[model samples]
Target chain A: MREFFERLGLMAEKAVVTTGQIIIMLFQAVYYLFLPPFKFRNMFKQMEFVGVRSLFVVVLTGSFTGMVLAMQGYNALKRFGAESLVGPTVALSMARELGPVLTGLMVTGRAGSAMATELGTMRVTEQIDALYTMAINPVKYLVTPRIVAGVLMLPVLAIITDFVGVLGGYFVGVKLLGINPGVYIGRTIDFVSVNDIFYGLTKSAVFGLIITLISSFQGYHASGGAEGVGRAATSAVVLSCVLILVSDYFLTSIMF
Target chain B: MVKLSAEAKVGIFVLIGIILLAYMSLRVGGMRFGKEEGYTLTVKLDNAAGLDRDASVKVAGVEVGRIKDIKLQDHKAVVVLRIKPGVRIGRDFTAALKTSGLLGEKYLELIPGSPNAPYLEEGEEITRVRAYADVDKLIADLSEVAVDIKKVTGSMAKVLGGEAGAASLSNIVSNLEEITYNINAVVEQNDERLSTVLANLEVFSDSIKEVAAGLNVLIKENRDDFTAGVTNLKAAMETLNSMAPEIKHTVSSIQRIARRIDEGQGTIGKLINDDTTHEKLNRTLTGINSFIDKTQRFRLYVGYRGEYLFDADDTKSYLSLRIQPKADKYYLIDIVDDPRGNRRTTKTEVTEGGSTRTVETTKTSDEIKFSAQIAKRFGDLALRGGIIESTGGLGADYYMFKDRLKLTLEAFDFHKDRNPRLKAGAFMYLNKYFFITAGYDDFISDVGLESAYVGVGLEFEDDDLKYLFSSVPPISF
Candidate 1:
């Protein structure tokens, strides 16, 4: 029992330290945002990496998520003689909850891992130290562009997700389930408000910040050799995913 | 394809995303473009519980605009509705909160007032607002009803719970029984008086029969005297021929009197010669003439029927006259020869040699019974009431199949000593004048007054009778 408590305390201590580092790293990224040599080129490149490359996967995930939601919603609402409600059900779920969340997880798995791996490799191979020796600010040069790109592009990706998701729900609800097309669209528009879409976009923007900052922090502080770089990349993806979900709950509670 | 730079690819991706976002916001989410289109109106509602900001405003089920805002004022909901252009509303328009489906979103519905009504300006408050039917209030009312029902049941359980309640119920039953017994005793006490009234009715019917018999006797006795008077009238006709010259002198005097009246020389002359009074007298005579003409045009039918009663083994005959003034109204008179005579029974107790024996005597009278009735017809059914077979009665006849078939029912002779006589029959018309009828009479009685009867009848209008007489061949001497 004593050993278990001691291990638990240690785990708690590690969690607090990591949380503090993430917060400080977020502040530094924000501080570097207005600094000199604004890297528009690098930001574009990171945007393409985070948003453009992840488009196909986001579309695929969003469509099937909406399709499945329609199928399940039809089955449930049909029991109450309300099969027409499936359109609003799928739309509300995608706009208010699933669209941003799935995009965050998907981008975290793809770009977040890449961010952590590249920075971890630079850190371990003495490239970041070399930058420090050459009188260059490493945090401003490396982390700022990725964070800016993430903050800008994730919402864009989420908007696409929401668009494709509604289309998928429309296809399934109207074509496959035999619901009237006009009624499907009317019910969807009736229930889903602009604030609901904005709610998802806002959550996605926060998730983007979380993903890029945590991954960058993990990579910048990476130790040991090549194995440590791999570890950092893996931890970045896992941590980014967990934080995205965790912060989503807080965001939803506050906004809604 | 040209190899685009990463920045160009990212820019294209972001541009598409922005376009999609714009479509979602404007088209799907119903977001206005820069400036909101349409004018806003204010309305006060009793309850706007499910209605939200941005809810649709519909006119005739077509979406015209949306709700801009909602606020509470003086314990009422004040809603701001933005109405689209080209949809003009009047000040008398009614605003109501309506739900789309059973568990769906609420929308504001603007019911347009009359076309001639004055147009309502923007930002004007709509005074006519209808309260929505709320599901929560309905459920709350249902719960209150359930509580009242529970309270009622609880009180009922307290009042009728045990042996005391059972005893009270028995007491009520005994009281009802005693009341019925007292009514029976009262009826028994009036039994003799009821018999006396029935005996008086029998005497009245006998007097009517005696009057008819006496008239027959008086006619027979006056036959020879009537012949002697006819001979005396012939001699008087010859004397009138001798007085023709004297009659002419009297006729001249009457003509002189008429000449004086024509000169307007007396009271009778003024009455006859005054133009207004003459015109009034002429109009009154014409009115009376028209009324008589109308009555003369009324239809008259004479009919004969004979019914064979199976149980009584007797044939009853009727000579009937029917006078019809309008298509739906008629008077009927029938002289019936009923073989099953009117019966009067008398009972008396005789005590002889210390033993009392009751003797029952029955007297039967064979007399002509008459029926006079008035009937009014409505569509295929005719109702009649007056006197049926010498008794006050009611009857109905249902005609079907272009009046080819008739179902008839009658009830009469409601005596205290017996059940009312009920007769039901069907008449099948063979042609305009001939019909066959079958029926049960006095079926409500169990003392063997009931009989099954079949009859054949012939009916003819006055015109038909005249045509029959005209068609007959002349006899040669």
Candidate 2:
């Protein structure tokens, strides 16, 4: 029983420290964001890496997700004789929930894992310590740009994803299933408002901050050589994905 | 070996992202840029349920603006709206707070007013507003009504389910069945009487058929007479119709005359109104009254006759006068316009071809003439000898029933015709001045114009008739 209590205590302590570090790191990132010995170059480099490179996978995931939504929505709504609602259904889902959440997960798997691994490997090899000896703050040099890039790039990626998803929904709804084109488009415009898209974008931006923070924190503290980097990368992906999904429900309730 | 600049690649990537951001913000967030991009409006509401900044403002379900900011003011919520360019919101537009769906999103719905009105200017407040409906209150009211209905129906069902009510219902149904049965029985009992009625109806139909057949024969036999009667009716109707416009004109003229007389306007008006002319009329009327009272002194009779000849298809008219010299003696004079007076004909036919021959002949002569005669009455009979149509003739008259009926005989035109043309007729008095005369005209030897004729004439005192004639407008022709 003592061991179980100790284990619970250890878990609670770890959670608190992690949350505290994330908040501190967010503040430092924001501070650095303005005080830019502005690595506009580094920010752009990271943006290319985060947003441009992820476009194909994001688009593919988004369109397929939307097509499946239309198919399922048609069947469900057909029971109620409201088959024309498929467009609004697919568009709303992509804009309000799926676009941000799915983009967060996919980018976590692609860029978040890489960020953790790269930073972790540098730490284990004493590169960060070397930077400190040169009187350079490693966080400023490395983590800030990635954080900024993630925050900036994620919303853009989600917007692209939403566009593709609506296209896919249109192809499936109107061409494959013979839903009225006017009703499909008109209902989407009618129900899926600007607020819903803004909600999605805000969620994506927060997801970006969470993803970079978790990955960078894990990497910056990483100690063990190769195993620690690998561990850090896996945990980064898993934590960010979970955080994305968990935060989504709260954001929807509060924002809507 | 690497020549590419990382900055350029990153710049392009960032540029694309910025472009996408612009597209996304404008398309999805409905955001715009620039200082004077869109117009701003203010609206105040009593209650703005579930509304916030950036809530859409729609016209006819199409979004044209959005809430820029919402603030609390003097016990009310005031909203500032930013409308897109070219979206006309009339001054009288109504702003209704509406929901996208039940328990879904809420928006400001602006229903436009008439199109011709001036637009609501920037910064102007929209006066017409509707608050969002409280669905919970509505549902509560509906439930209350439903509860009342349920109570009423429950009592009704209880009343209908009672033992006595059921017995009454069953009895009523049985009574209805008995009534229908009695009706059927009565109908069966009257079957023979219904048949007898039907047989009498058949005999009545036969009698109607016989009457229709007799009418058909009568119509066939008198078809010519009916045609003549219809022709006469048509001529009379034509005359009356032709006189209608003239009569209307005359009526208007008479109205003018009456008005003129009232206004004392022209000679007739002067005659009626002037004392001298009035005195003259009064004296004439008095003299006529005195003469009528002294009818035994000069008992003269005057008559006018109009006759229609079927053979000649013409009319003959006459004026007759009878002067009483004593209580039993009288003189008669007549003026006649005869359609058939005399006839002459000459015929010549060429015996050889191409030989010229001509003949002139007179078939008939029409003229006006006067005839006079003297008669002495002995009780109800009179003997007379005089000229008839300017030739010698004699007549005897038998009067009956105070001269209401008279039979007369005349022989005239002896030198002109093959045999003396004789006329025999009886006069039947119909009224004070009218009589009907039917005569066998020129039937003595049938060589002259012979006809069985019928005519009507008027007989009255000569002085009375002469006075009436003088009062009328003179016939010019």
Candidate 3:
């Protein structure tokens, strides 16, 4: 029982230390963001990698998600003689909740892991120390551009998701389910608003900051060579997805 | 197309995302670019529970505006409406919150009250608002009704539960059946008689229809005669209508005379009501009867004469009635309208400015004058001595040519300061009832009051007078 207690204490201590490290790294990245010697090129590159590259997968997921939502909504609302509500159901879901959350998870899996792997390889191969010896601040050079890209690009990606999702819902509701075209479009416009889309984008922005910061934190202190790099990548992807989902609920509760 | 660099690709992607967001905001979300093109009005609703901001405002099922905002004031919903620029909301309009479907979004509906009502200006309140019916309240009321129904149904079940109740119901049914059976039997017994009566009625109705058709044909054939008769009747009615007032005046005068006699107000009334006056009138009538016995053979000639005077340039008229008691003896009475009038001279003493003097003035009055005369004829020569034109006078008439022509001379007023008036005239009779006369009046008067006159006269004897009186229109009393 003592050993068990000791083990629990040690795990708790490690969790606290990791949480503290992540917070400190976030502060450093934000501080460097405002400092001079800005890196527009790196930001553009990261934006391309995170937002542009992920467009295909985001569109695919978003559209299918909306189509399924319309089918299910039609089935349920049909019982109540309200099949026309399917358009609004799909639109509101994508704008207020699904659009930002799904994009965040997708980008985390695709770009967050890559970022962690690249930083982890640098930490393990002593390149980070070499940068320190050359009086270079590694966090500013490596993490700031990524955080900037994420803060900027995640909302852009969410906007694309929301647009495609609404289109897919319109196609499925009007063409497949045979809802009145005017009613479908009219109801969607009546129910959805810019504020709802902005809510999702706001959440995406928070999620973007989370994805980059946690990934950088996990990979920046990596010690083992190949195995640690792999572990860091996995942890970055896993932690980002979990944080994105959990934070989404809290944000929705507060903002809405 | 040129191969796009990574940075260019990223810029394009960001731009696309922004453009899409903007499109959604403007098109789908209905966000405006500049100032909204509308006027705003306020409406207060009683239970706008399901209404939302930005809800459509429709007029007769067509959208013309939007609900810009909703506010809670004094526990009521006050909605601010943004209406399209050209759409007018009359002052007499009702705003109602209505749902599209059973569970749809709430919208504000504007129902205009009158077409010609003046429009409501900007920032005006739409005071006529319809109270929204809440679904929950309706459901609650329905539940209450359902509870009452359940109680009623429970009572019904209790009342009809037992064997006794069932027996009573069966008894009622049996009684109804017995009544219906009796009624059916009665109807069956009388069925033939009822049909016979119905047939008779049908025949009677057909005969009546034939009679009516005959009447219609008769009326159509006599339409022109009917119109002519109607026109004649209308003309007669108009004549009577015009004479109504004159007839009423005559009747009223007769009534007044009768009432005066009844009230003992006039000579006739005194003679009837007073014993002494009655005795005196009876004695006088008895004495007059002796004279009337001789006058019982009396013949009356009523005549009128009109004359024009050359010097005066005016006309005189006389209505005369002559009574012939005998073949040679007659009395004449005349009512005359004289243009010369009656003349009187007076002297008045005046004391003005300490001097006494007398003023002589002559007065002339245009009063109607009367003449009563008696005449006696022998051998076509007549002599008259009586009042002539309101003065005592003597006159002689000489007949010529079998009495078809006559010559007359008169003198009167000898007491006046002027020479006694003398008049002469020649009369020519065209028939037994009509005569023309030319005369010189007051020719001997030194006051130069002489004038030559030409006159015509009509006389109706007793038989002719009776016919004339009978022809006059009758006046009802």
Candidate 4:
């Protein structure tokens, strides 16, 4: 039991330190966003990787989620003679909640782990120390463009997801279920207000910042060999998902 | 020429990323920042069901515009609709709130009324518009009505009972007893009367057969007589036709007399038409009353013996009597007689062997009595039992009723298998001579079998027959 207590103490200490590091990293990312000498090329490359390249997976998840929601909602509402409401129900749920959160989780899995692993590898190999010795600022070089790309591209990805999701609902609700095409589209538009889409985009931007800062903090502090890089990658993905869910609730509550 | 700064690379990436992000946002979000490309029309709705900022507006299933914005103003929903600029809408166009599908969406559907009407200017309101009635509320009302129907049917069932309310406690026992008694009585009464009626029917049928046989023999024996009678009738008709001119002249003279009376031309005609004639007739009737009074004041009695008896109660002593008695200066009379009494006393009684049997007996008195009976005559006829009896001959009387152009035919006691007692005839009208008549009678032997007949006739009338014959001589002999 004493040993268990000691282990708990160590875990608590590590958690505190990690939390402080994440807060400091968030501040540094915000500071870099407004600073001069923004890296447009790296930002573009990162944007392409995060936004454009992520399109297929985002669209696939968004559409399948919307279609499944429509199928399930139609079955439920059909019992009450309200199967026609499936289109609007699926659209509102996707735009206000699922679109941003699901895209955040997806990009975290795809790009967040990659960013952490690469940075963690450089840390363990003393390459970050080498940049300092060569009179180079690693934060500006490695972090700024990724932070800019993430903040800019994530909201774009969320928008794409929202559009594709609504279309997916339209297909299932109208073409498959024989719901009137006009009614499906009109209900979707009427049910999902502009505020809902804007809120999701804002959530996505915050989630993107969280994902980058958390993954970079873990990677920059990584010690040990390849195993530490793997651990950092895994922890970054898991932590990004957790922060996204927690922040979504708070954001939704406030916005609504 | 060798080195590029890290900041430059980062700057380029950031700039490109921003541009791509902006472009993507504009494309995916469908954000159009410039001016709208259509004439705008605004419609207000209480509820805009599932309409959005960029929702398509359709007309007759054709996409023509988009919904620009939806807002609530003064507790009423207002939807700003933007139509394509080149599309011209007439002023008389009607806008109806329509649904995409059952639950899909709601949009304004414009139905153009008249093409010749003036076009609606841009940004003008469509004053005439209709909202969609909520189908959900209608369904709810139907369900409520169904519930009421169920309740009413349940109450009706209770009121009607299981056997349609036929049973009442008071009648149950008494009705059953009465029904049994009536059935037994009817069965016994039918048994008694059935045989008697059958026996009587058999006798009646035998008599009918005998009568039919006799009728057949009579008809066969008189066959030639019937033919000769028909021939005699034809000869009589020819002779009557030879005398028709004189008859026609007499008919014309009578018609002229009737016409003069109708026109109040002669003295009798004036009596029929003038009030003074009526007054004079009334005075003459009053004078006859005074003469009858004077005659009644003379009392008298007369008697005469009669050999014949008019009734079985009359005896051999017969007399004819007429008596009048005076009472307070007026005369009154009474008469009584038995004429058959005298005839009965004088006749001999005969038996079946044609031998007379007589016994000496005193003769009863028989009397013949006479009394005055006064009756007034109207025109040339007297009415009795709703039939007219004329002082003139039957022919003239017939003519007076049905003129000379009219023929009175009576088919009396005519026997046919279908109609034994049939009577049918036609009377032709004068001038136009179109006569309509109908007859219906039962067959004597066939019981209920009967025959009906209808007849039409023609006649001609002329005042100057000689002149008419001279003007149009016969074309064929």
TM-score of each: 0.56, 0.49, 0.56, 0.41
Q: Rank the candidates by lDDT, best first.
A: 1, 3, 2, 4
Q: After superposition, how far is residue B96 of candidate 1 from its true place, in Å?
A: 4.6
Error of 4 at B280 (Å): 75
User: Between prediction 2 and prediction 3, which has the larger TM-score?
Assistant: 3
- Tens digit of lDDT per residue, candidate 4, span B154-262? 9877866566444553467789999999998987879868788889999999999999999999989999999999999999999999999999999999999999899
The alpha-carbon lDDT assigned to residue A50 of candidate 1 equals: 90
Model 4 lDDT tens row, A62-154: 999988888888889888677768977887888788888989999999889988998999999999999989977677777766777788778
Chain B TM-score of all predictions, in order? 0.37, 0.33, 0.34, 0.29
lDDT per residue as tens, model 2, B1-477:
765565665566557656765664455443443354579998898877689777789998888988898988998989899999898789999988888655457889998888888888889999998755488668988999999999999998787788977988899999999999999998799989988999999999999999999999999999999999999999999999999999999999999889989888988787877888888889999988865554445566888987766566777778998777467888889998888775544466645677867755557666786789888899998999888777788889899989989998888777543578788889999998998887777786544477677788998876775455334545110
Against the native complex, each candidate's DockQ, computed on alpha carbons, is 0.54, 0.24, 0.55, 0.03
lDDT of 3 by residue, B317-402 (tens): 99998877677888888998988876665779999999999997878776588889999999888998899878898889999999
Ranked by DockQ, the better of candidates 1 and 4 is: 1
Error of 3 at B212 (Å): 16
How would the docking of model 3 be graded? medium
Q: What ranges in model 3 sit over 4 Å off?
A: B1-3, B31-34, B72-75, B132-477
lDDT of 4 at B349: 59
Q: Where is the poorest 10-residue window by lDDT in model 4 chain A?
A: A186-195
